[model samples]
Target: MTLKELLGIFERQGIKRIDPMGQKFDHNLHQAVAQIETPDAAAGTVVQVLQAGYTIHDRLLRPAMVGVAAGVMQQVNTSA
Candidate 1:
């Protein structure tokens, strides 16, 4: 699905979309959908959201809403 379609999910879910390039969720969403690796259920949800036609941005400048596996640690040091 195109990025425009992905942002629609956020609008439906009432979640705000942020433009964080290289972000995990963004990256995962793109990778999963692009590679057809995302779970069936999740992919279905994405399709549903897109079909709903609810987009985050008003006109342009919107990103994708990704559903990635949780618990993955960020690169930031947490052992301080």
Candidate 2:
């Protein structure tokens, strides 16, 4: 009846949600929509999830749309 109940039914039917937050980026499970430069998290880590992903019985139904963390670029001094 409610959304939570529906989700529970889906879960009972072997549907699982993929949570990518704070996890390492995986091409198979996550689709990187954007890359953000930050020093807070390691590069190639999933920083945000734009869309949730799902799987059924170990088969992926959809990949999670996410934003991956990129290492901050440092300026190189060329002046001698």
Candidate 3:
């Protein structure tokens, strides 16, 4: 069977894809490999997914390897 067909079979068996591309970075679901500077999207947004994650039912089978937009984690105005 083709890879697509195999994936379909897995999906039918309750395998779900965790494609969090363009979604907000979640520490619980995603593993941020790098924080890149990108103005194309909001900071902390998932810019790229190195590896797709998977799940079965409500259990997390794997965390997605991703790169998130870079920005100040906590911007503080020192000038008063």
- Give the Å error, residue 19, model 1: 5.0
Q: lDDT tens digits, residues 1-80, model 1? A: 88777667656766554442333443333333232233333322332212111223353233354333333233787896
TM-score leaderboard ranking: 2, 3, 1
Best by TM-score: 2
| Model 3 spans with C-alpha error above 4 angstroms | 72-80
TM-score of each: 0.22, 0.91, 0.82
Rank by lDDT (best first) = 2, 3, 1
Task: Give the range of the ten consecutive residues with the poorest summed lDDT in model 2.
Answer: 3-12
**Clash count per candidate:** 0, 0, 0
lDDT of 2 at 13: 99
Span of ten consecutive residues with least summed lDDT in model 3: 71-80
- Top candidate by lDDT: 2
- In the range 1-80, model 3's lDDT, one tens digit per residue, is 99899889979989888999999999888999999887688998999999998888867889999999987556689997
Residue range 16-73, candidate 2, lDDT tens digits? 9999999999999999999999899999999999999999999999999999999999
lDDT of 3: 0.89
